[model samples]
Target chain A: MAFLSGLSAFPITPSDRGGHVDTAALKRLVTRLCTAGVDSIGLLGSTGTYMYLSREERRRALSVAIDETGASIPVVVGVGALRTDEAVRLAQDAKASGAAAGLLAAVSYAPLTEDEVFEHFSTVARESGLPIVIYDNPGTTHFRFTANLVERLAHVPGIVAIKNPTEKPEEISSHLAQQRSMTPKGFPIGYSGDWSAAEAMICGADTWYSVLAGILPDVCLRMVRAAQNGDVEEARRLDATLSPIWDLFKQFSSLRTVYTIADLLGVSKAEPPRPILPLPALAKEKVAHCLTLLEQDLA
Target chain B: MAFLSGLSAFPITPSDRGGHVDTAALKRLVTRLCTAGVDSIGLLGSTGTYMYLSREERRRALSVAIDETGASIPVVVGVGALRTDEAVRLAQDAKASGAAAGLLAAVSYAPLTEDEVFEHFSTVARESGLPIVIYDNPGTTHFRFTANLVERLAHVPGIVAIKNPTEKPEEISSHLAQQRSMTPKGFPIGYSGDWSAAEAMICGADTWYSVLAGILPDVCLRMVRAAQNGDVEEARRLDATLSPIWDLFKQFSSLRTVYTIADLLGVSKAEPPRPILPLPALAKEKVAHCLTLLEQDLA
Candidate 1:
C-alpha cells in the first residue's frame, strides 16, 4: 500500500456501558477489517470517534490498530487538535508510537486564523516522523476551512494527502485543477462522503475515505475499483443500493449510526460511546432494513 | 435571597497557558462576587468553560468557589454530563464536595431525548444531596428544549429551577407558569442572556446569570439589585451604562472574553487552557474597552 490510496475502512469502535474504549470489541473490528483486506487501517478518524476519546484512550486505540494490523497494512492515526501545541504533541506522539501516518483535521474549537492553520500544520508536519494527511471534517461550526486556507496548508512542511468532505464537488475539483502541481507531486486528495465518492473521484479526488466501509468494506472497495476501471455503470449500481445505508449515517449521529450498522453486520460489538446516545428502536429497525438489503446484495 | 431573583453571573474560570485551573485568580473572583453580593455565586456554568474542563479541574474550581465564599453566599456548580452515569457521579461528587447546589446543563455533545433528559436529571437528583436545577444551555445543540418537555420534566425528581438562555423570552416564562405548580413549593425559574439580564428579569426571570460579573461583580450586582427593586427604569439606565461591557462578552469567545474581563478587573492570574486556542489582539482590545466601561460605571 503506497501511502494508502484505496478503500480505507475507518473501523467504528465499540464502547462499554461505562463509556470506556472497548478494546476487546476493537480487536474484533481489526480482525474483521483484516479478513476483509482493507487497504489501510484508519483508526481515530471522525467515524472512529476520535475527538470523544481521552488522550490515553486515543493513544491506546492508535497503538491497538497499529499492533493488530502488524505492519501488514499501514495505520493512519487521526491527530486533529484545536490548539497548535496539542496537535503537534499528538503528531509527535503518533510518530513515536509507530503510526505509519497521521491524518489531522483543519481546525478545532476556536476558528483558526489563516496563518494559525498554516503554522499549526507546519509545526506538526515538521515534528512528525511519518507522512501527514489533512482532514476537512468541518461538520461542526468549530472548523470551517475555506479553499484559501487549504492552499495555505498545501505548502506546509509535510502534508502528503487530504480527505475533503466538503459539499461542493466542482469547487474541490476546481481547486485541485488550479493546484495541478499538488497531485503528481504526491498530494492526493481523497473524498470522504459516502454519497459522493464516485462523483468526487470523477472530480479529481484520487483517493476514497469511506465511513460506510466500517461495516461493508468489500462493497465500498469494489465500488471504488469499479469507478476507477471506468465502470460507472457498476459503480452507480452499487451506490444506488447502498444509498439507504449511507443516508442513515448522516440521519442520526455518525458515531451512533455507524456503530448500529456494525452491530447489524455482526462484525463489531454492541454499544457506542457516551455523548452519542444509542439508536432508538425505530432507528434500529430502519438500520436493519439497510443491513438486510446489503445482506441480500451479498447473497 | 429567596430563590435568587434574577441575573446569576456564571463567572468564567481563569486557566494558565497549560490549561490548569487558576486557583489564585479563582479566589479573587470569589472575593469580588462576595463583595458585589450577587444573588448567587454561579460557578462552572457554560460561560465558565465547563465543557472544556476535566473532572479534577471542575472539582477544584467548585472547591475554590465555595471555600472563598464561606457562608456568605450560595455557590452553584455546573455538573452537566454527556453520559447519565457521569452526570449522576458529578452530581454526587459536587454535593459531597460542597457545591451549594448543582446547576446542570442537559448534557454535553449529544442532543437529549425528553425521556433521557428526565432520566438523567432524576438519577442525579436521587443520587446526590445537592438541590439540582435543570439548565437548558441548548446553544450546545441545534435542538431546542420545548415547553412541553420542561412541563414533563417538572414531575421528574429533584428539578428545582429552569436556567434558560434562549432568544425566545417566552420559553422560561412558559416553563415558570408550569413550574409554579410542579416545583416543590419554592425556588425560581431563572433566565440568562448575557447583557439582556435586565430585560429577561423584567419578563419574570428570577435569576440572571452574567459572565461580566466574574470580572466586575459590583457593576452586575448593582444592576441586579436595581432590577429587583421594581426599578426597570433604573435597571435600563444601568443597562445603558453596562451595554459596552456586555458587548465585549458577546463579541468574543465566551472563555476568552470572560478571562480577559477577569484580568482587567485584577481577579484571575490564569488564561484559557492550552487547547482553547488564543483570542485575537482586536478581541483583547475589545475586552479592555469593556473593562473601561465597567470602571466608568463603578466610578
Candidate 2:
C-alpha cells in the first residue's frame, strides 16, 4: 500500500444523503483517497463523526471503506463511547471490518481515575490482537492524563501509540516528549492536533491524524514527509499554504469544523448528523475561502 | 408516604450482594424516607448512576422506588444519552418505571451547541409524556447551556422544570431571572451546585438539587423547607453542615465521594457502577466527616 509511512487526512465521512451509512459515497471517498495517495484511512473515526453514527452505521462504514480501499492502506477506526463494553464490542466489529488497528478513546462516564484509565485501555487492548492506539485526548475524557499516567499507560501490551490532545503547542511538546521517551523504539506516537504538526514532528511525534489531509492530501503528505526528512524550510512553506484551513478550525469547535470544511469542499457534502452544530454564517464563509484556496492552489 | 415539598436524597437503589436489584432493601430505604418525611425520591437518576446500569436494572430500580412510594412523592428519573433514539427510549423507560418525570442531561458528546441542546431536550420531552426537567450543569456537560438556549428550551411542552447549574450564585441568578422572564409562568426552575442552595433559592431558583440530600435527606429537606418558608437565616445554618460534602465533590475527578457519602450514611450502599473513580483518601475522610456531622447536628 506504501501507506504506512506518510500523511492522510483524517477525512470526516459524510452521513448518507438518505440519513444512514453512505456506502456508495464511502467507496467513492475511499477511491478518491487512494487516488490522492492518502497513506491511511481513519474510517468511522472522530473525524468521521463516529459518535453521531449508530452502531450499525459504524460497522457498515468501516466495511465499505475496507472493501473500497481493498487492503491498500491501514484503517484506524475510532472506538469511543460512554461504555467500555460497547467500545470493546466496536473494537471487535472494527476487526471484522478489516481494521489494521483501533484508535480507542478511553470512554469514561464519570471521569475515571488514572488507575481506571489504565484498566479501561488494558481491557480493550487485551480483547484484540490489533495494535491499539491509546487515544489520550483528555479533552474528551474530561480527565486529563498526566505524565505519570502516560508512563503507566505505556506499559500496557498492544498500546502502540498515543493520539494526544495538542490544541496548545507547549502542552503538545510536553506530551510528545513524555510519550516518545516512554514508548518502545518504533512504536507509533501520533498527534491528533494537526494545527501543530510541524512542531509535533519536531518535538517527537512520528505520526499525525491530519484533518487537512482530507481535502489537501498532497499538501498534507508533502508537509509530513518534509518534516520527517528534517526539511524544515519545505515543511514550513507547505504549512503556510495550509494555514487558512488551520485558522478555520480555530474559529469553531475543532471537531465540528472538520466536517464543515469537508462539506464545503464537496468531498463530503451531506448534512452533519443531528445534534451537531452547523457552521455559523461567518465561519461558513471562512470555510468557503479555505476550500477555494485548496481547489485553486493546493489541490 | 406523606413526602413533603423540600430537598430529598436521590436514593441509590441497593443492589443485592451479587449485584442484583435489591427490592427488599429498596423498600427499607423507602420506609426510612417515609419516616424522615423527605420531599421526594430522586431515583434512577445520576445519584442512581442510571447510565451505567442496564435498561433492566433501571426499570427495576425505578419500579421498586415507585411501587413502595406509591404516588406519595415525585421521582425524577435521569435520562440522557449520546443519541436521540436512546434518550427517547430511556425517557419511555423512565415513564414505565413510574417516575413522576424524566430529568435529562444533555447528550454526552462535548460542546453541545444551542441547536443540539434544544433538540436533545425536545426529543426527550416529546416522547416521555411525563413532565420534563432539563438538567443543565456544565460540571458534567463541560458545555454550558446558555440562558438564551434555556429560555428557548423552556418553551418545550410537557417540560415542567429547569435543573439550572448554580456553581456560582450570582451567575445562576442572572440566568435564572432571564429564563424566568422568557419561560412560561408555571415552569419550575431548580438549582444544581451543592452548598449554594440558600443563595440559589433567594436568587429566583425556587428548587434546589442537594447533594447532601442523597445522604442527609432530613437535614436537606428541612433546609429547603426553611428557605421556602422565608427563613433564610435558618436555612443558612442548616446549609452550613453541608459545606464539607460540596468540598468533596470538588476534590475528585471520579465523583466517588457522591456515592461513598450515601454508603457511609447507611442510606443505601450500592457500589458505584464501573468506570467511576474511587474516593481519594482526603476526600473520603471529608465525606465521612460530613456524614457524621449531618447525623450529629441535623439528622
Candidate 3:
C-alpha cells in the first residue's frame, strides 16, 4: 500500500487559554496518533484550524508534529492560504519541517476560475519539495473544483493525491471516474467526509482521511480495514454504529462538534479558534448521547 | 438623509489586459458615477475585486476614486480581509486616503461566530476614523451575522450603517424587525442585492448599494426614487423592465456579467481577476440581447 493509503489521523492542534497553540499538548496528541497504529497523520487541517492560526503558529504546530512523529509515519501539513505567495511560503516551511506531503486548498475570498485554480496549485507545486494532496473542501473555500479542473490539476507535478470532501454520491462517482480515466495509475485518492467514508471507500477511494481516527483510531481503523477486506457488510455495520456522530457533524460543523467530543472523551482540551465556538448546550447533549452510544457499542 | 442614503454606486475597479488595476480607467468610472448624480460611490466593493488586489493596489484604487470624486460624494472603501490585523490596516488606510466611510465584510476562510463578528467590527471601528458600513454578505463570507450580532455591532461607535445583501423577504423582514427593536431608530439600513433593491427599500432600507448603479445609475436611482415616493407600482414596473438582466445575474455571477456589459457600453476595459473568467459565449449573447432591450426601453 502507498504511504497515503488507509486511516490518516487529522489531529487537532490544541491551544492554550490565551489562544496560543499549546506545543506540549500538540506533541502529546501527535505521540498518541503515531502510536495508535494508524497509517499516517495530518497536521494543520480544518480540524487543525489552519486558517485561524497565524503563520508562525502553523509552522510551530507542523514542526512539533514532525519532530514527535519522526519518520514513524508520513506527516502531511495543510498549507492552504488566501494568496499564492502566502501558500508558497507555508509550503516551503512545511518542506523545511520535513513533512512528507503538503495539503493545499485553492482558498480565495474572491471566486476563482478553473484556470486560476490550476495556476495556484502549479505555483505551489513548483515551489514545494513535498508532494501535494489537493484538498477539495468547497464548503469552506466556496471554490468548487469541477471534475475537469481536477483532471487538469492531476497533470501538475507533485500533486500526487486528492482528498475529496462529501458531495452527492453521483458527484463522488464522477470524480472517481475522472481520476481513473485522466490520471496515471495508482494516483491515490482519499475521502475526508467522515459521514460518507464507507460509501466513498466502496466507490474505490484508496484511503479514508478520517477525523474520527484522531480520537478513536482503533474504531475508525476497523471500518477502513473492513472496506479494504471487501467485507461490505462489516463496513456498513461499522458505519451504522458511527452514524449518530456523523448526524451531529451534519447538523453543526465537524470542527466545533469534534472539539466538544474531544473534551467529553478526555482526549484533548483543544477548542476551535474563536468565532467558531464549541457546540451549544442542545448540540452538546446530543453529542454526549452519541458518544455514550459509541462507547457502549465498543464495550 | 445620511451620507449613506439613496443610491450608492459600487464601481468596478478597472484593470488592464495584463491584470493590473487601470487607475486612469478607474478614475473615469468614478467621475462618471459621481457626475451621474449617485448619492455615494462605493469603491473596492466585491464588485471592485477587493480580494484579488494587493494591499498597495487596493490603496491606489481607493486613492484614485477619492481624488476623482473630490468630496462631491462619499467614497466608501471596502476594507475587509481574512485576518483581523489586515482588516484593521485596510480600515486605517481607508481613513488615511480621505474616504468618507469604510465598508467592511467579515471575510473569513474559517467560519466565524457572532462574538468574533462583533469583535472584528469593534476593533476596526476603534481604529478607523471614518464611519463604517457593516456589509452583511454571507454568500461570500460564509459567516452569517445573526440579528442579535448585527444589533450588537450597531452599538459600536463608528459602525453607523448596515448594507445587507439579498436574502429571503422573510429574512430581510426579520432582520429589519430586529434592528427596529434593538438598535437606535434611523440607523441607516441599506440593500446591496440589486435585483431585490426595490423590495428591500419598500421594507424600509434607507439606500441601495448597487452594482447596476455602476453602469445604469439613472435606472437604479429611478427605482429607488419610486420606492422612496411610496409608488410601488412604478417601482415594480421599472424592475420588471430590467428582469431580463436580473435573470442573467441570477444565472451567472453578477460580477462576470457586469464586466461584459461594461465592455459593451465602452465604460472600461476592466476584467475580473485571473481565475474569474469573462462571461462564456452563450452568456455574452444573452447579455447583449438584454442590453439591446434595455437600450430600447430607455429610449
Candidate 1, residues A1-299, lDDT tens digits: the string is 34677777788766676657778778888887888888887788877766556667788787777778887878888887655566777888788888878998764433445556676677778866557887877564245666677776776667787777745644666765755554446667677878877666556567788877866788888787887788888888888888787688668855678888777767666665554567888999999887887779867
lDDT of 2 by residue, B66-97 (tens): 88778777778877766667778888988877
lDDT of 2 by residue, A139-205 (tens): 6557787878777777778777767677466677776666668766666677776778877765656
Q: Considering summed lDDT, which 10 consecutive residues are worst modelled in model 2 chain B?
A: B1-10
TM-score against native, each model: 0.88, 0.86, 0.78
Each model's DockQ score: 0.26, 0.40, 0.29
lDDT of 3 by residue, A179-280 (tens): 778777888888888988887777778888878787678888888889888998998999999998888877776777878877887777776655456677
Q: Specify the poorest-scoring 10-residue window by lDDT in model 1 chain B.
A: B107-116
Candidate 1: list runs displaced more than 4 Å. Answer: A81-89, A106-131, A140-142, A166-185, B106-119, B140-143, B166-187, B277-283
Error of 3 at B296 (Å): 7.0
Ranking of all predicted structures according to DockQ, beginning with the best and ending with the worst = 2, 3, 1
Looking at model 3, the pairs that clash are: A113-B275, A275-B113
Order the candidates by TM-score, highest first: 1, 2, 3
Worst 10 residues of 2 chain A by lDDT: A1-10
The best candidate by lDDT is 3
- Order of the predicted models by lDDT, top scorer first: 3, 1, 2
Fraction of true A-B contacts recovered by candidate 1: 0.18
lDDT of 2 at A270: 67
